[model samples]
Target chain A: MSTPENWTPQERQLHDALHRSAERVQPGPDGLARIRRRTAVVPMWRRPVVLGLAGATALAAAVIVGGVIALNDGDDDAPVASQTSTSPAPSPSDTTAQTAPPTTPPAETTPPAQSLTVPVYYVADSGDGLRLVREFHAIETSLTPIAAAVNEMLTAPPADPDYRSLWAPGVEVTAADLADGAIVVDLSAPPTAGEDPDLAAQQLVYTATAAAASAGQDGSLPVRITVGGQDPSEPIGRTDPLEVRQLVQLNDPAEGATLPSPVTVTGEAAVYEANVLWELRRDGEVVDSGNTTAEECCTFSPFSLELDLEPGAYQIVVSESDESGGEGRPPMSDSRTFTVE
Target chain B: MVQDRTGSEADDAITDLYAAHYVRLVRLATLLLGNEAVAEEVVQDAFVALHSRWRRLREPAAAVAYLRTSVVHGSRSVQRRRGVAARHPDEPPGHAPSAEQVAVGGAAADAVVEALRGLPHRQREALVLRYYGGLSEAEIASAMKISNGAVKSHASRGLAGLREAMADWS
Candidate 1:
């Protein structure tokens, strides 16, 4: 289709000759079978199958909507995992917290005694705008989740091929500490090198807030970022201004966590009108699907749904529909696969 | 609910894709990677990833394009993992040229390959996808995740460089 106007007859002859030559190379005889055998069992933990496989355990996980909370100190008094007609299945370990006082707010009052995989946000340039990409980074419980996540951000590049980072070379999050109920982040250098300064700033803010939320930090804290100790008032493109919990995040069914039918999906999302769409698929076919509303919208708030399916390998995907209600762009979404027993 | 992927319609589709495109993709990969074994591995991985994400693929018709893109990226990652030069110390037996290799059979083919290999990765990819893969500029751009203009730029520069190198070889 790309014929060159200035092409020499000899060059055209060479192109034809090269094309004919490359066509002769062949793969080995068993190449097809080998590829099929290798790819036969695509693990359920892949991107589409966000939830891990469900086993025979049949533990119903109750979706804890509203806010992501830190695991309580009294392991002995953890709420008992339970099954209610309408409640989402609860993981075995989370059963003890079933009786947790709903009124109490979670705080970073105590250091985590357990490890957590904190979701760090990075920017994916979509040509039109920058979309936030999330990747879970594992941190030792000994390290504060927020601080550790920022440190990880400095060295870790986005694993997704479509996404990249704007963090300039040698850009370091010098300090990340909670004071006056806000997470103050000190950066060695600004991410001004990127195409958009606002997106670069949001990348840091979203990642920091999500990290804090994942660690069970009180979601009330706002991320206040300072470059070289100077505050950039009203950091551009601030999404969640009200509370830290405004981060649209999945708090339950931790990545790769197994679950049972009537599985409850819970996460924080900031949608146009608190609406989130959920679909359940087993073996790539939709089995059950619907929409659920979060507590509120225009900010990250908790939402929950209970899905019942016959025992099988299933992936649950949750997405926020675009406001126009037209399928213009890919909806912001998250998914996980879990086996239903 | 057990979503049975093995031996199901999805598996059948994968098998069909494997049968239809496996060799061509292998050739494509080999052209990009300059090695047979790694090309095989990269194509296999692409299929596996495709199978895993099959459900998310909005259009089943785009599977070929999807496979092409995945193979391209997979080959890039392999090259990256292997460092600047993907030197395979464990080169399998048969360093000897195949009958097919003998058939194409000349210093010109070798010179073309050498010239193609010497170009920058983007330029080489643009040319291979264009001439060898027989992709349109738009298709090449989609496969490489770049703009059409970029695709045209890379291909033109690549072809010019290849011609220059071939002239020197003569």
Candidate 2:
């Protein structure tokens, strides 16, 4: 490479401009801390069994992977109806099953079913276009994780008003099972193709795959969609996140979570220079505003922020910085209303 | 005593390398990836990977080379995924001047960055490594996993492309 002394004026200008463009990029103070934390965690490949149960915490930790550890002997067909009765009370036999040793036979132990959190994908309008977003919902079910997640994706209204399912209401999962390394989902009726047919199919594809992954199955499995007794369509697989997902997403302090002080906000975003901006609001009034950078820019990567706040209901909205300098479309954002006590 | 000394030596090497090169490596990655957060992650991952294989890479110079190559490879993987995601036929042109650019009033620099973002991945990588990273042709070639001749061609083509893209600025 030619030295700076040998550079032509044009080359010098280019060099100067490049340096100036990145001059403002002073990385956050937590880089070393973050790297240490990641290094400390045993890589998933080294601990495959623990990988399946990785994010299961508190209430969801009791959820048995694969859903084969039948917690309830109740009729599997009436999962919703049985939910109310089984939640508040564990039968005498269920208590015995819970205390049984690991050596006990599978046929003898029947523990009570517990609520588990499953990720459900929903469609939302990201200023530029419609894309998929996800929310974790705690559901009490005796059915497999894939079945419960698909059922919720079909039936439940998203907690966030900005998000909605493209799947028509009243549609239910007839069956959801892993077969031949792909998830096969059977629906009660064929879903009407929305404005975007591929994205519409992707809603279920993302949901089923996410549910499968959470339940310890391969998350990358293509989803085979069968409507009624009809033949299945070409298997739907996950599209690149940048194309199908909102550019900004908030993954922590889930919608309406109540927790203590020093709340940690984290999510993934693909924004210019990885600049993620945020605003905290209480009763629709802005209380705090700031910015954080994601791990990388122009593609979805993780970003996190910590906030210490007094007791109150707050809405934290995170967005991409307006790279257009106020000329292009509004920056995409995701927000959640949470409380701190 | 020998095991303890080796362990402490390893820790010292990592600490010294981190202090000396962490920020610089992150900046290099940010220039390549156009996302500071991802760049930091890429560099951090490089450090973590280097730590695991530190015994094999005892020399500081060799460790630094390992980091640069890892960052380059990591950035390439990220760009490949992004390329697939951004393959939409109707996607718009390159990035516009950001809010910070407007605030700082560095329209000229912003224009150059925007033009750079529009270049092909290899060409951009080559140019960033040469002009901004100040790496020699051989170093660039090693980091990018390409031949020295390829690096020269990519840098020349990238410079020409940037000039054309930023023609309005000049």
Candidate 3:
């Protein structure tokens, strides 16, 4: 019920004056140039290989939570196509078709390929009422094409570390499709990170979308992100992914577990935010990747690497940095002993 | 299905996004900060954030909205960090207003400046975007994230407040 008609010309003039003043002072070229100068592009290859889903296999040496459904489906009955060890391509007489390398595996390859499905789960603790949240889901058929995309994202410098810890470490994945397009991800815990239901739902959305893409589908695998199979009010990632690591022990990774691939990283974050980095080493020469925040947070990065480390014993480190680049978190590091043999 | 943006394609998308939006964002930030230098810094921070979370966004089209929202958040953070209050004139004109402004009368401009110093944060933002940026009510709503009703409310209240303060000055 405001009417400028009641006001004097002087009042109107004053209002216009202040508005103009604010506009006149609006930032300009000098300010923009400074911003452009500040944000340098961090080299892509230098980033760490995101854990899990590399070239379709995630690099994260996932610490299988207790709640995991243990569904290593499609992989069980299929003959374990072993590469005739380099030791000997089995005597040619071995019926191995030595080189039938079909330009296209006989059309029969379709049936077996169709069964290549993995049900991966991303579970977040929902607090009291909702013990299990099925964040997202999808069918196996829709995701195969998305592997390349997942591999592309995973290989980038800023690979996802143990983000589940942010939701709740003790929590478990009851079920997971890992496939794109309406992926169904089930978790066995309540959302406790924040009271905002949106925040809880976001954890589900991000996990589902990420997991789905890992399974392989181009465009949006619009995950029907849900809590215990129920729809949410809104999606996640409002500002930052909510800190869900509280319920789970995202702190220390398994002692002897090894990363599935080498990692590289470079990013600038603020002190308060979490800066997660995954390190890969071959023969003691370690490659570090991930962004730690510096002042003002966003910083240009120009570091990178892509290495193929043969299976063997090596040490991988997880480093956390605060806004000031002050190393925080438990600062976990350990030597892992594994052999391709 | 959102196009499966391949790694190289995504990078190009990002570069393209930066090229297209960087300047506009800086301009937006400048208006918000009331200073070009600070505006650039704010806009830069927003872009960096956009880059970091590029993988998480379900739809790449939403990127512009994300950046706009980030600009607001970043400016607020900067304000809090600098302990910025209605900016005070520490020194008069680092450059002279020149001959044309001589007739406008320094006192009237001073009165206007003082009045602006009195408005609250959201009010200032709305008014700046409305008149200065030549943005419509809907545009302001998108930028500030409030409903059109809320924006109209803020603008109305802000302009009224400015008028009252100016009356006090004269």
Candidate 4:
């Protein structure tokens, strides 16, 4: 096969035509500003020094809690579920002293300073399939971002009106460490008994990777899961080591994520001939919409569109075209709800 | 207050890089994703990630490769999400292109884009990286994380498919 250099006149014409088409496309102003907003400097939680300090603080808190347990009259069954912070608090010692213990409950400690807004990924109903709901949990920066994020995922109840967590509340993040750009996350139990373990694994992968990015890892890292000290024989969902999370999904403007007017909806899709449809709706009424082409078709490809809308709630739906070029057959689609401010 | 010179210096370098490469990178993403707005978001996202890891990137020259890799991976994610959106049948149809859009670029340009989109992902990536991106085969391989031989095959197949798709285009 000939390269572009040796291509026939027709091939050369096609190449030129392709170039001209690209030349017509240009990003709107504020592109840089938008990027700056999404990416900020890694916080103190990711730093080794602060993480060490957090460990010491946790140890001290554990000792205080142990003393509180000793003061109680052998009420060893005190529930540990009340303090649902992302960092795992140490359990109280079981050794009982000969002296009589007090009966008063321990006072709540003051919250830590400098909290980080970490995105916790949860599975929510989206049509027939599950779409990710990203909820921000503000945890002390002293807590390691990974531990805190995962801990919250396990303990914090889903706050979104319609969202829910599939991982068992008893599940715990035994340990998490970054290895060779991949995070090895140890869990106390298997994530969930749901029919598709892959989706459950994805929730963890998305949460961990997002936490990593928030902590300053520019690239999204893959996650390897181990349960009760053994790597599961089955595969766990991980960000494509060679690719980003989209693999055939959208990442931007997460569900229930708010945005400004003239919002841009972005995602990935492999459709018939790269023909994808995008529509904007408010309260089930079509506001504005358009059909756009992706970079490639018949395989995973990138798709996006920009819509101008009033400041209000709107749902953006992107779908694949059917055989009649989006005329007749039922099309497959992905949708996200976002507020325009 | 005294500030660290190295930190500020790194920030300045990234600012300069963004000024110089933002448009080019956005266009690259636009070619990969086929939407200007989404392409812009992807490019911006790449730059932000780059900013976060700028120090580790080591050499200034490596920044372009890093951005390219990020854009490619990001596009994959966007496509996957789009595929899910396409599954439900109740949504309204997308708006057709405005008359102004067609008149501005003409039908031939549209056909080229439509035909280019028809190619497989790898082939389209190879062609866009080579023709519009003006990157060498080695660079494309590096950006795509594919072998050099695979790049050549994809480019050849992509050109062949494009030629066939646009057979009737004037």
TM-score of chain A of each: 0.49, 0.65, 0.29, 0.49
Docking class of 4: incorrect
Give the per-residue lDDT digits (tens) of candidate 4, residues B1-170.
Answer: 01112355555566667778888777776666666656665777778788778878757789878988888777657666653223222211111445775676546766776777777888888887887777888999998999999999998888778776567765
Each candidate structure's TM-score, on Cα atoms with residue i matched to residue i, is 0.44, 0.45, 0.32, 0.39
Candidate 3 lDDT over A1-341, as tens digits, reads 22357645764565456444433443322222222222333332322321111222211112121112132232331221222123112221221223322221232123233433222223322221121112122233322322222222222211112112224334443333322223333334444553445444544444445444444432133333223333321212211211222211122122234555443223221112333444554433445344333233112112223335666654443333322121212121112222221
- Worst-scoring 10-residue span by lDDT in model 3 chain A: A127-136
lDDT (Cα, tens digit) per residue for candidate 1, span A1-341: 65656556645555654554556556654443344334433332231211111111112111121121222222321121111113322222332243323322232233355566777766542211355656676666444567567756765765433345656556666555553334656566765454566666677777776676766765434555655545433322234322212224455554445677677888877655777887776554567878889997545568998876687776676776544232133244555656667
| By lDDT: ranked, best first | 2, 1, 4, 3
| Top candidate by lDDT | 2
lDDT of 4 by residue, A230-281 (tens): 5422223343311122212444566677888778778776455677777676
Evaluate residue B20 in candidate 3 and report its C-alpha lDDT on the 0 to 100 scale: 72
Candidate 1 at B61: error in angstroms? 10
Give the runs in model 3 whose Cα sits over 4 Å from its true position.
Answer: A1-341, B1-31, B53-64, B82-110, B165-170
lDDT of 2 by residue, B5-71 (tens): 2244655576677778888887777777777756776888898888778888899988988999999
Output the number of the DockQ-best candidate: 4
Q: Cα lDDT for residue B40, model 1? A: 72
DockQ of 1: 0.16
DockQ of 3: 0.12
Candidate 4 at B138: error in angstroms? Answer: 1.0
Q: Give per-residue CA lDDT, model 2, range A1-341, as digits (tens).
A: 77999987777878877777666566644354344333333322342212222222222323322232232222432332334233312232232333323322232233246587889999876655577999999998655677678989998888875677777676887656554345667677777654678887888888888887887766766766665524555555676665577878998988878999999999998777788899887754568898999997666679999999999898888887764443444456787888999
